[model samples]
Target: MTSALPTRRFGGFLFDMDGTILSSIASAERAWTDWATRQGLDVDAFLPTIHGVQSVETIRRLNLPGIDPVAEAHALTEAEMLDVDDVVPIGGAAEFLAALPADRWAIVTSAPRRLAEVRLKAAGLPLPGVFVTAEDAERSKPAPDGFLLGAKRLGIAPEDCLAFEDAPAGIAAAEAAGMTVVVITETHGHAMDTAHATVTDYRDLAVEWDGASLKLDHRI
Candidate 1:
């Protein structure tokens, strides 16, 4: 049997763009792999664990003894930007976001503004009223800063917001921010136990935002 759909009252919703709203895993993986090959790094071994992290951070995590994190990140970003065509919206994401009240939702992503805009526009997803990009926050996901900043922009408390994330780092970020989290399992194969709930995609869930409260019909 499937897990029950969880519901809660949230003042606003914060979303992670890449894998959560737009399905950019393929493009991201290809870019990273190509960059890794160029760097003489083990593409097959490190690519999966680096997904959802900022390119610079990913390089640092590799701890490649002599690698310059900043330069590598720039290289990867340039490659990924060129690979945007492979990105697209996750199934049902567009309709689901459309059904939500515009002011109550925002995009909180680790992507830099330019790349985020390129991917979102490519996917044809409506831009959220509020957007918190990597440049807007001092720290990225797993740090709660992005989500908290998004909530602050929306004039909502972190605890009063809900976040949709596809990576364990993002789930941890939202949970640390005291917000409810819904994990979408499209990019990562691993399961996250920390999320309030999980869904294969938006098609398996339903949502409605009344002016006073957001009603999530998660039976599916």
Candidate 2:
């Protein structure tokens, strides 16, 4: 007989907000476009690179000489929260999350905490028990700081956490933090070789509380 449940258990889950759990690309693009236009920068050039990184880092990367980076980031955050009409959860996201123990999962996002919360609420997703945002880390995605900090805050060891990501930078961050990654394809196309697994939607995944711990199972 085959086992009905997955055997491997994880201490906790680390999820990326924008593309992994809730789909917020429209709101993000709207805010970034307005910011880029106001700053007289190349919107086409900058938009592609900002998806998985922190807004402050993106501002720095743009190297705008006159704008105050901190104030600019704040402006962007306010803009993001103002227009969340299109924000919604990815397929099966809510159901999968509802199945897990609240303490066993958290969100690690490149968005500032306020923006993250706004988007989550707009998308009708529950606020996570532990939330890690751009303001919580000295560095963002592609750096291990955010993910490591999130795992630490969850009271879980780095290696025991499973991270779900939708972009290359997030995948790198999770791996650098010593956690295995499950690459969700809501944003990225082909799965990176570094990811432990890949899924097009949360439909392929299921989480369960196995009495003592939470575990994840996938179809492929």
Candidate 3:
């Protein structure tokens, strides 16, 4: 017999977009791989580092001579915007999001606003009312700036929010902002190494709000 699942409540919810709510891996990897090839870098080595970080930060890390990271990142976003044909929402993502009260949730992503918007549209997800994107933060994930901004926009304290993420950078960022994290393991091929709670998808999760705080529970 299976054991009963855990339940928790939070004043607000923060979500990381690409991997947690939707799988943009195909479109993202395709665009990044082309960029890496153009830059004469090892595609396999460079691709992994691109996930969960801003394109500007990813480009800056290469330290390639004469390359303007910001300009290149913008160009990359332009390219990504046109390639959302393969983008799709993660299983049960839309339903889970529908259950949450709009004012109590926000999307915090490392992606720039335009890119994030285009991708979400392609995946058929709603545009969140409070979205904290790369331009809204001075620093990217693992720094907590975006997550903190998201909480602030929701009018909730950072520690009172529960964050959902699917990458190490995003998880660390939420934690740094003093929020508990739940890792989404749907797109991962290997086991995630985190002490935070993990779920493969939102299919087994449910949310409820009764004129007060939001409560989330495993539906098993």
Backbone clash numbers for all candidates listed: 0, 0, 0
Q: Write the per-residue lDDT of candidate 1 for residues 126-163, one digit (tens) a residue.
A: 87889998789898878999999999989988988888
Error of 2 at 143 (Å): 1.4
CA lDDT of 79 in candidate 2?
83
Better of 2 and 3 by TM-score: 3
Whole-model lDDT, model 2: 0.83
Candidate 1 all-Cα RMSD: 2.0
TM-score of 1: 0.91
Cα lDDT, all candidates: 0.81, 0.83, 0.90
TM-score of each: 0.91, 0.90, 0.96
Better of 1 and 3 by lDDT: 3
* Model 2 per-residue lDDT tens digits across residues 1-220: 1123325788888999988998888888998998888888788887888889988888887777887888888888888889999999998999888888888889999988888888889978999888998888988889999999989989999999889888889889998999877777765544456425667778877676776667787646
Order of the predicted models by TM-score, top scorer first: 3, 1, 2
